[model samples]
Target chain A: MPDHPFLLEAKGLSRHFGNNIAVNDVSFSIKQGEVLGFLGPNGAGKSTTMKMLSGNLAPDKGQILINGIDLLDKPAEAKACIGYLPETPPLYKEQTVSEFLRFCAKLNNIPKKQRITAVDNAIERCGLSDVSQRLIGHLSKGFQQRVGIAQAIIHEPAVVILDEPTSGLDPIQIREIRQLIREIANQHSVILSTHILPEVDMLCDRVQIISEGQLLFIDTIETLHEYMQSSALLLRFDTEISVQQLNAIDHILQSERLADNTYRVTFAPQHDPTQAILSKSLVEQWQLTMLMPEKHSMEDVFMKILREER
Target chain B: MLTISQNELQRLFLSPLAWIILALSQLLLAYLFLTHMDYFNALQGKMSAIPGAPGVTELIAMPLLSNTGMICLLITPLLTMRTIAEERRNENLPLLISAPISIYKIVIGKFIGTLSFFLCLIVMTLLMVMSITLGSSLDWLQVLSGTLGLVLLVASFSVIGIYLSSLFKQPTVAAISSFALLFLLWIIDWASTNAAEFTLLSWLSLLRHFQPMVQGQMNSQDVAYFLIIIFAFLLLTIRRLDRERLD
Candidate 1:
């Protein structure tokens, strides 16, 4: 198992409801110790894909292998290695956190002797130890989400699939859950589906952008960062300069003056206008006081990809 | 499957609805048991004057068993309404569906969990029926046959409730639908009294099949009818759950 490269592998997954395709020919894999961010807009089939991978819903066409066991052919064995938390946490509110976790441990087929240990471990990992004895319905939304996570990891499944785990929580709860997810990534491959772009940036080692039931992009976070790098620079001159003076710089594709001395300049992707602008500013006595690259936000990268895919 | 059933039982006990229903039904049945015993006591001397009269088994135990069967029909839908429907409504079914167990196990586990509660009710009724042994000589064979009939009838009821519960997301809807279906099957024999072609319907009536066994007949045909009902509904529930995953 250590020699195997992928802990979870899904191939050509496709699912359709009546005439509408929810997921179409999507394939991806996650290696051990890797956190995969499933990014998409609403109704982009991220949840549907998660359902297929977790064995909750069957794919019309595909194969999912968890720890090298075929999921469709041998579901119970394969599912033993997968932990899933759907969009809404599947929780029985009548039970306390410990009781619910114990049930999950049993459902995962953990040995009866080890069930208590498993439940305790999950509670500790998800930061639910303090509330373990509290009723799930009485807990806050954040605590309920934590209980959801606790159940998913109770058996230490190799692949943990969580769909929007941090949705509908305050900032502190989101931070705490994100930290817990980071801890989980140390031992298990995590597939986190969320529309929150920053969540993906902060937690995922790799990213997959899905749209319209198709995977539009798949690569490391570094590649996604590369897409976030825009070919634009913000320059603030101490002296008020004319438009013609600002137009003298080389590699400047477009230029716009916001105030009397502020100029926003666009350049080609491979061109570096910073050195050219500095020299030009000195020669023209533009008295350049500020020069900074305009970085595209994660939202920009996400929207751009989605737009291009369309 | 055992884990799922245990969890289901735990859930059932956690809700106040189950406890309230359990307490009320038991109280009502106990009241009925006392009333039946009192009537039997009042008629005991008068019955001894007859040549061949019905004893405690026929006079008290069979009626109690039959009434318990009727109570089972009335209460089982409420008990089983949340078995699968609440899971769907609360969106907790994914927890089971995503687990390593098969759908067959989930359906069977829910059936067993809910049926076990009904079994408790039967046990309570039997205890009441067995109380007759302290004061009067009871016909043990007749009591055994009647208890068997009650168990089979309740099992059929529970499985149908489980099946109906699987079909809807709202527990109330599941309960109402199950009650309607059970009531229809319970009284289908009433129609056969007036129509000749309705004999088949009478044979399908759950009440008709239950009556012979409670009378100590123990006919294979009656037993098979209950067994077939239980088996068919269970299979349908399993199929519905499997189709749920597919859909």
Candidate 2:
């Protein structure tokens, strides 16, 4: 939906640990310069999929294409174009932040002459300049997460895949990390997997919901809401009305009393509940103050999808 | 590959465990040298009381090289306990595996870094050899040959430590396993004396192989034996790292 070329594509990607299928025929595409939010509950194969894309784990079946390059066929070239941060931050506690970043820069194959500048840029971008010399073991959880991000982006790859980047951060730290993700999205496409619903609403341009190792749905935020259509009208009445009188209307599919005077009415999708209620109110000489269709929240949709799968 | 080696070297020196190992090893070598010197003096006094006493200090004191070899065997496991084990314990193996570098390079870089630390310890113990030269008719050629033998011996044991470190993910387990393995090898050598004619265990004794070098006899077989062990273990270490990455 966003105006960008597709930077990553997974076609029938799957992973099996012995007889257990961790990821089952999952497929999705992420576009360049777009933040695609990956939402799934625990044990939903989010980490497994990310590992396959990053070349850390070979997929049992299917293909992964990075910038139209087949990952399995040309793993080195495909890996060179992407960066990944695992769910757990893989850091050596004995090493300082600067030392760890330097290792990461070299591991990513950054040129020897440019390693220092690249590491410095990552430290500045991740807001880790103050604690760059501090041992990673001594830093707080939030700063450790920042160091993890610094390692992931030190080589300046085209796509950055982060698994639960804000899993253990405080509210303020979460906000700061969210801002950092947004800043990084300007330079590279991001695939952020998180269980937090509001994070998706705040930062993601498009979302894909996966459950039970299967992709349930993929759409823009506006389109996802449209998928969860509601046929109920919420009405606030100035005059008090009995439940029996509201239910007596012939065209009413279902009616429920909200309070002393308000009522909620559900009609078929083709039926206009507001117009029907307005006509009924005029015939009954009753005043209607508010009439609006009930809209579903993203949280509601996310929960519904999860619950339905279970 | 160079970057990985540099980082491993930095970590090896920065750890407090390295300093503790160095201090303990130096203390042990000093104590062993003092005790050996006392025994040598007593033997010399006995030999002087005889009518025709050949200068046998060289032969009697040759065991010091074996003592040095034993010391190397005892300390190598501690030096290499953290090579691959610590990385796995801390879940940092993925950091190296996900890098663009090959697994062979990672293992080789770590092996060289660990060997460098062991080489430093060998240099420190050269002070003991210096003490042996004072007020005694010590054969300089024999001393030099023994020192070379000790270097090869330590290198061989360190390679075994690296291989065992890769086999286990816990540093304590790796260290204990290496100790048990080396102790068994020593016991086998001691137990095979009576049946030396048919005992294959005598051939496996690392100390037995180093004896010729300490006596100023540079046997090509001993040199080849040490080289073969080092090569075999290093190859195994490289394979272990590769298996971990694949898994």
What fraction of the true interface does each of the listed models get right, in terms of native contacts kept? Answer: 0.93, 0.46
What is each predicted model's overall lDDT from 0 to 1? Answer: 0.90, 0.81
Q: Best candidate per TM-score, number?
A: 1
DockQ of each: 0.85, 0.50
Which runs in model 1 stand beyond 4 Å of their true positions?
A: A279-287, B194-198
By summed lDDT, the worst window of 10 consecutive residues in model 1 chain A runs over: A240-249
Using lDDT as the measure, which candidate wins? 1
How many Å off is the CA of B62 in candidate 1? 1.8
Docking class of 1: high
- lDDT (Cα, tens digit) per residue for candidate 1, span B168-246: 9999999999999999999988876564454788888999889988999999999999999999999999999989879
- Chain A agreement with the truth for model 2, given as TM-score: 0.85
Candidate 2 lDDT over residue span A1-310, tens digit each: 2233678999998788878888999989988788998888888888888888888788878888888888778766777778888888888788999998988898888989999999999999999999999999999988898898888888887789999999989999999999999998888899999888789877888999987789987889777766567777788888988777777675668889888777888877776656656789999988989888887766788888777767
Best prediction by DockQ? 1
Give all candidate RMSDs, comma-separated: 1.9, 4.0
Compute the lDDT for candidate 2: 0.81
Per-residue lDDT tens digits for candidate 1, residues A1-310, read: 5566899998999999999999999999999899999999899999999999988889999899899999989989999998999999999999999998988988988998999889889998888889999999999999999899888888889999999999999999999999999999998889999999999999999999998899999999999999999999999977777777667778888899988778898999999889998887777777778999999999999999988878
RMSD of model 2 against the true structure:
4.0
